[model samples]
Target: MRFQEDSIDSAGFVLRKDEVLTVILGGGKGTRLLPLTEKRSKPAVSFGGKYRLIDIPISNSLNSGFEKIFVLTQFNSYSLNRHIHRTYSTNSIHQKSFVEIIAAEQTVSSVNWFEGTADAVRKVLPYIREQKPKYVLILSGDQLYNMDLSDFIQNHLADSETEISVASNSVPEDRIYGLGIVQTGENGFIQEFIEKPQDISQVENCRQQDGSFLANMGIYIFNTKTLVDVLEDLSMTDFGKEILPKAIREKKVKSYVYNGYWEDIGTIRAFYEANLMLTDDIPKFNLYLEKTPFYTRPRSLPPTKINHAIVNQALISEGTILNHCEVHKSVIGVRQFIDHGTKIYNSIVMGLDHYGYFDRRSGKIPNGIGPNCEIRNTIVDKDCAIGADVKLLNLKNYTEYEDEYIKIRDGIIVVPRHTTVPDGYSI
Candidate 1:
């Protein structure tokens, strides 16, 4: 169904949001995003300066009028839970709307943590079923994209025979691996499903007319009955690996092709690359659009103060003070303090939460980038204290390394949260 160009509200819609529930899978331990995910859950990881990775999915859902959401979290969810509680609050006007956290808990029937994507939903089946939703929208917490989810719902409702609607996007042939590939007939019904095929022939078979293969976006809209029955009948762990392929054969599943910018921020390299891409002259994924604005916790901080700093092609957030530094093509987060003579290029400096003083009463050096530091192609996580004359230039030709104060991946250094890089240290 072609989505209405006019107000989606006035458009001939077949369903209302009251009949649907949204579930955001926060995933298990994000091992690939190590040090960044060390202190917080993958969904809670900071992204685009001030927002968390999970905000992308939640914002999309909320903007689509699906306000009642349950964020399923597993590993290190304390920060995530706090962020949600602080950022989103339900008032008397929208009493029925809420953004709640559903942490993994041992029940009488099951006593294990979420084994996989499908298993996580399986364990929450009781809670979900109680709501009596006709359709369930499942989303990934760590993906970076903006989707009008009403289109997904309207597309599913347009075809009454479709029991499940899987969101798909065309990906280049070389990038088809590690993604659930879909083969669709001319009628738009998914004919076959493959789980990360290594063979080139299999990928070519799933190629669309646009010279790209159909890859699952990890976004699904399943009929409530179909989802419950499939979970009860199979002992599957993951949806992409097990359930999706089998469902294509037995159930009436269709692909809702999304021709928009979407990136799965799963690995460290993918995360770093996606963050840096936002520094472009005109980023593909725009966050400044008021019509589809990205939501986050609002802090009333003072305007950023720049003291003779040469910042070009950089995104400097609020409450940052740049003093005689040259930052090029970087993303400086909130409340950042960069001293004089610091030359940061192609990097991400995640600012601190509080101001740091040089007084001995504080007992610490200070937070943020110190003087005479030369940082390039790096990611400085939140609340880091970089002493003077520190060079974060990984001189070796290595892909990854783990050290006391830094972690390097894909030749990009990552200084984890609260890390203190002493003076005169050359990494």
Candidate 2:
């Protein structure tokens, strides 16, 4: 399904598809999400089960009638580039709608990669100028949320005085520690901005009537001229830390409050929890919403086959074979093979890229969990081979631990991609 190319805003103004250009920031290094980002970029990391992190923002933009999207990527972008090309490339019929990948290049003028988020966009101003979009909507590629950006664009257009509009969400004081906080005065116009405040008292006045502070969602709608003017200073790299604070002080910046489920899948723990949350009866971020469905690369695989598996509160994707295993509150990704007697609880098993029948015959520790294995509070990345009787329970409850095969961060065990756990192995 496609959104209309033209629509009327709330203030009775025609909104054209070319008016806005969407830029999704494929994050840098992604050190926090280690192993997962080891081989692929942050945006290319698998999420929920079948979809990549980049799919979220691109899906939202397409659903919101803004299709001229540019994904800025730098480190480990091969998989990201391929995924975008395979999934988002439109047919020739939709000439104006395109999802282009703009990788950081070393030109004669500059011999460096993207310094930061702001710098990444600044470097791609030449490509953006070609589109001649009136507004530029910047979004994070690693966030999980379902937002109607049409409303966000409409809100920004409703107020002619506003040059930049930031999407803000009301979060508790304790949750605002590592998030950008904004203080808004009359008519929801932002008065001050602080990035990742160490002290809560620094923005005490920004607290709302409900006692929640407005935290930046890292979603922004900027006027093209305003964006160009602010990025003139090359030293200002990050939007949250530098560009936003300066914009608030000088320009008419307003906060568009977003009351929805949003999660930053930046760390291993956060990624694990966010995947588990989807197993809930009524998940905050609904993937089943028919109107705003999450888009991904479609696969032509057989339906999942479960042979008397006792599944409860789990989200198991297609092409999986569960043989008499008990799955409780877990998210099983695509093409998984769990043998009989295995019990998985509070875990995320990122299934294989392809069937391992040939690999199984070769006897090189076939992908997927073997029989009698016990997995609890763990995350198994793609193409892993867990042998029989292997236990990844993290029984000692260590805050942090690492070895050649596995890592425990924030008490959750993580078996990195392409790892093999031998028989009877225990953690």
Candidate 3:
């Protein structure tokens, strides 16, 4: 399972755009993210400062020169669909290169919605088979990481006998139970695959020599014929739970070890920590690399206006205006307006889309952080209206609590999209 460097030129192993078809699975309910996924799909949820979660994989594929991509969407996919349509267009690159979306639709062949990851791909096999891809690249939409897909494909091509190759990484011991565990032999071939083993000893047995266990990264490279054959014979709903384990028993599967930063933003605590990590002095994952930069829709927003505002160690997105505010260790999204005498600490203020639309049209309080509010350890989702003198401190340390305007998870207050906190309110 080792690639012979001399057999293949490392300098010229280029996976052509036409040779591969990338399928991005973006059809999750994202129940863990709750209010954020209430209106939009998980992949459509905003991430970092300005980009969506879907941008990571799409950008990685494009940067690796694989342009034929199909994003599979289901469950509250309006915003996700709109974002994809507005952002990605393949006509400029090549006539054959495109980023098309194949949503869950009712047809004569199948009337049910996608059940899981495997089912999602199974339902869209018709569109994928039509492309006639030599190797199919399957990716998850909610994970945040940068990878050169050509390298993964090149490794798979080097071992031409293997029908499947999976991308894996060494994960910390505490996170073993949350991910699928891969047991690889000495030759780098997958021997056993366990999906979320409850017993700690099962996870411990799979630990590598480096003290980290090999966790599945959810990135797979499959031979087109083998993929179709497996799908046709299996009635499994999920890949990790059923398809992968069965594939390991039958097909020749190999593991490509990735020693890089990868985060699966699947839960509220995970999302909160990942966002706050950007404010650190030296972040584990750097998003500002020029060689392989992250791509997103370019909003020609005005420069952030700061009028005597004291901010520290924060990621401030474009078009935000802060007046006489003290923001410490926070992230301010696009078009956010913080009025005078507001103090926000360890919080995320997702800005509004328009200015005074709610106040002018409906004569309600303006959409954004109003004057003299103090927010601490909170995540304010998009288009939120905070009336004057509102405080969201989470004093009770409620592990989980939900109300009309707020939902606290793991001590972080989450204000859902379009929610309004009336004047003089306190949480």
Candidate 4:
């Protein structure tokens, strides 16, 4: 709903003021999105053509009028840190209001890295306590969605006694093994919380009145004092296995049913499918929707252009130059340069790093000596170069590669960093 700070009047327990603080869990390795996450953390992976995945939550928080924001990072957070600071901000709200990075910094006790998700919070509990906010909103940075968090906050206000509010969604049984399952009582309070149920039958039993099962969204809203008290009481520090489940057993956790477009873009197949899905005119998650726009660092570049090309169902980023090529059902990241007669179908062309090896190998980008080169079902990571008349086709139907140049994950060929498959070679 894009709830701005100045737009709303006072609603004490309703949390209409700027007293709410947001802590984004952006530290995960994103091991699922391999090759792409080969260097940077998960949050920095480019998404929706123009924005990174972290932009979804940051933009969501900005739209919900929560100015006090802190993004927690772990390994390789420099890129993630730079991207967060550059994109989506909370301005005119002052020091605490702006979007900032919060890694596992030094402490009097120790400078140990964040042990777990909840432990990450425990280490920063002192700083968070200093702010003395009534509520601290926590979110995992990897999920893809556009939600009105104000609604979730209002739901929390309606049940102030609940110590924790977890965002839950309906999921199929095959997917429940990786998520926390919950059962609600007649009073709409949570009765039982299962951390990734062991048995398939037990997982199916956690159903709503309409026979739908509720699964955790990895998004939490915590009461400040309750959170502080809990951190002080426990040595364990993971939200799924420790905090929320423990809180649920104490009868202090409530489920906030989230009926929105939410997808866990953590795996290679999921990431690939998600990006390609955006090629649709009416994608499930449309960034152009003015009611709730996802924010990112505004790149002051010219619009995308396709010359002498046959492009289909692809999201082309700004400053991209395509000529005499075929880009079908894929995403091309910013500032991509395409030469004449290069066929890129059902593949992603990201940053320039992928082309660095080729740039270094050949004196020039090997002038296209011929045409009819078909590169399909692969990820040519940033800065990669393909020689003229090179062919990198999906061999699932033909035959897998005999050599180690291409990596096969879930049957998709991935050309690694600074790699060259040689010109006109077929697998």
Candidate that scores best on TM-score: 2
Compared with the true structure, what per-residue lDDT tens digits does model 2 show for residues 1-427? Answer: 2347677766788778788999999989999888789899888998888999999999999888888899999999999999999987752336788899999999988898899999999999999999999999999999999999988988888888999999999888888898999999879899999899999789998889999999999999999999999999999999999999988889999999999999888788899889999999999989999988788998999999999999999999999999999999999999999999999999999899977762455666777898899999998999998988999989899879999889988788989998989988999
Best by lDDT: 2
List TM-scores for all candidates, in order.
0.95, 0.97, 0.94, 0.90
Ranking by TM-score: 2, 1, 3, 4
Which candidate model has the greater TM-score, 2 or 4? Answer: 2
As a TM-score, model 1 comes out at 0.95
Relative to the true structure, candidate 4 reaches a TM of 0.90
Candidate 3 residue lDDT tens string, 1-427? 1112122435555445587899999958999888788888889988877888899999888778788899999989998888888889633576677888899999999999999998999999988889999889999999888888877887787765789999998998889888999999877889999999898787677888878889999999999999987788547888888899999999999999988889998888888888888888888878888878888877878999999999999988999988899999888899998988999998887777776543424557788888899999999999888888999998898999988879998779999988889988898
- Residue 251 CA displacement from its true place in model 3, Å: 0.9
Instruction: Rank candidates by lDDT, best first.
Output: 2, 1, 3, 4
Off by over 4 Å in 4: 6-14, 88-96, 209-211, 353-362, 366-372, 397-404, 418-421
Q: RMSD of each candidate?
A: 2.6, 1.7, 3.1, 3.3
Name the regions of candidate 1 deviating beyond 4 angstroms.
1-13, 91-93, 358-364
Q: 99, model 3: CA deviation in Å?
A: 0.9
Residue 181 local lDDT, model 4: 89
lDDT tens digits, residue span 268-319, model 4: 7777778777888789877778877788888778777778888888878887
Pairs of colliding residues, candidate 2? none
